[model samples]
Target: MHRIAVLLVEPVVGFDATIAPTLFGAAADADGTPLYEVVTCGLSRAAVTTTNGFALLPAAGPEALATADTVVVPGTRYAPARSDGVLQPELAAALAAIRPGTRIVSICTGAFVLAAAGLLDGRPATTHWRFADDLRALHPEVRLDENVLFVDDGDVLTSAGLAAGIDLCLHIIRSDHGAAVANEVARYCVVPPWREGGQAQFIERHMPADPHASTAATRQWALDHLDEPLSIEQLAGHANMSERTFCRRFREETGQSPGGWVRSRRVERARELLETHDLPVDEVARRAGLGSGGNLRHHLRRGLGMSPSSYRKVFQGS
Candidate 1:
């Protein structure tokens, strides 16, 4: 079994401490057996107080670091001197105790701790968007991308604020378990399973100011007819324009091509039903408009590099 050690520093916030165990601990094969074990550790084996006024009894100390396949540092209230991007000395030493090549993850301001240890130098990472500017200024050597929900840089990973930590942890689960197991874990945790590293962090759709020119109707119509054979020609006719003009209009409205938008939504729907229902894969294919499990497998592989059964295994609501 894979072992993950979550390092809790002083004044551990409630949110970060809970993400890893829930995500990693839920990983299992079809037999309903555990695939990974997560241990919560601290600088020492002490009662670590949380920001919510609760105290936690850590199961291990920094010695856990040497045995950790992955080490995670979560947000703390002890950021000082360096402001939003500072790390305390004891926390720094605990980080230093981690074995080399151990995958390191940071939740919210925990990126500050990794940054201080120089682990993030010249690496792309993100923290909470609210403190993104400060993180950038403090560690410009570490490329700070503020728009992604999380950044997966091989050995190191970093996430946005509190809830995005959920996304990041789910991502790590997906990486470790393949899409099947990760999807199940997401269902168990009530989170999305496989948001890619490149997805927009939080791009809100702009409601049409001029409803007359809006693409909402076209999008809705496409969703309603995902099973039917629909193409740019059909959508353009619905919009009453040449295919080329309709294509331009669609991209302008959604920041992605019509095909890309349709594909993403299909995958999204497939994911939802996979997590919420136990329908036969072919039925799921029909509902998601992917035709057959074979076809679903084809597209899922092209879009997510996994099969439908595999994706369902990970994302299914447990």
Candidate 2:
């Protein structure tokens, strides 16, 4: 089993600290065999304080990092890293214990720690949007994309605030085991199975004074009708709004234009069909609203860098 060590620093965001262990621990093979060994550790055996009122007693100390196949640093309010962009000697030493080439991850403001240690230099990353400016000012060498929910730059991954940590954990599970295992874990945890890493971290929308004026219902309608051509005028008609109003409200609610959202959803639908059904590629493409196998291949390759057959083989393991 792969061993995952979650490294907690003082003043950690309690929510972020729990995400990895909770999600990874829930993952198991079809026979109910646990897939990963998750352990929590801190710099020392002492109780580690959290941003929340309570503290956590780690199962081990920094020495555990040496044996980990992956190391996760949860968000912390450690001033040296958060403010000065430098790791304190002890924290630096603790990180140094991690074996070289071990995959590293950060949740929320934990990106600060990784950036400070120079692990994120020249690497794409993200953190809590509220701190993106601070991170940029302190570490200009890092490619900070605060707009997305997370950044998966191969060996090093980082997520945005709070619940985004859950998304990143699910993403890791999916990458390691496959979408089926990740979906099972998500079902057990009662969270959404997937949220693309490129999705916006937050939608800046002013709630309409009349709630009935929202486009949420129309979005749901679009989802159900993904197999059919969904023109803006048709969607606007369903939402009982003019095309102009519908387009404005749709972008506000979803952070994407109507066409872009539909394309992404179609790709997602194609992926799901590819994974769960062994239908012919053209059939899957038609059901997903991509129109043809060639169209599906174009979108899948552009978005996921894989073809439909390749995706099915990877996720379905056949």
Best candidate (score: lDDT): 2
lDDT of 1 by residue, 1-318 (tens): 889999887788778888888788878888998988899998889899998879988899988998999988887665561475666677667777788889999998788878878999999998877778887888889899987778988899998878788888877776565556677888888875555555555545445466756677988899888877778889888877788877776766655678877776676667666666888888888888777888777888876678777777766523
In candidate 2, which residue pairs clash? Answer: none
lDDT of each: 0.78, 0.91
Per-candidate TM-score against the hidden true structure: 0.71, 0.93
Over 4 Å off, model 1: 81-86, 205-318
Clashing pairs in 1: 180-310, 180-313, 180-314, 181-314, 182-314, 183-314, 183-315, 184-314, 184-315
Q: Cα deviation in Å at residue 59, candidate 2? A: 1.4
For model 2, what is the C-alpha lDDT against the true structure?
A: 0.91
Off by over 4 Å in 2: none
Per-residue lDDT over 125-183 for candidate 2, one digit per residue giving the tens place of the 0 to 100 score: 99999999999999999999999999999899999999999999998987777777888
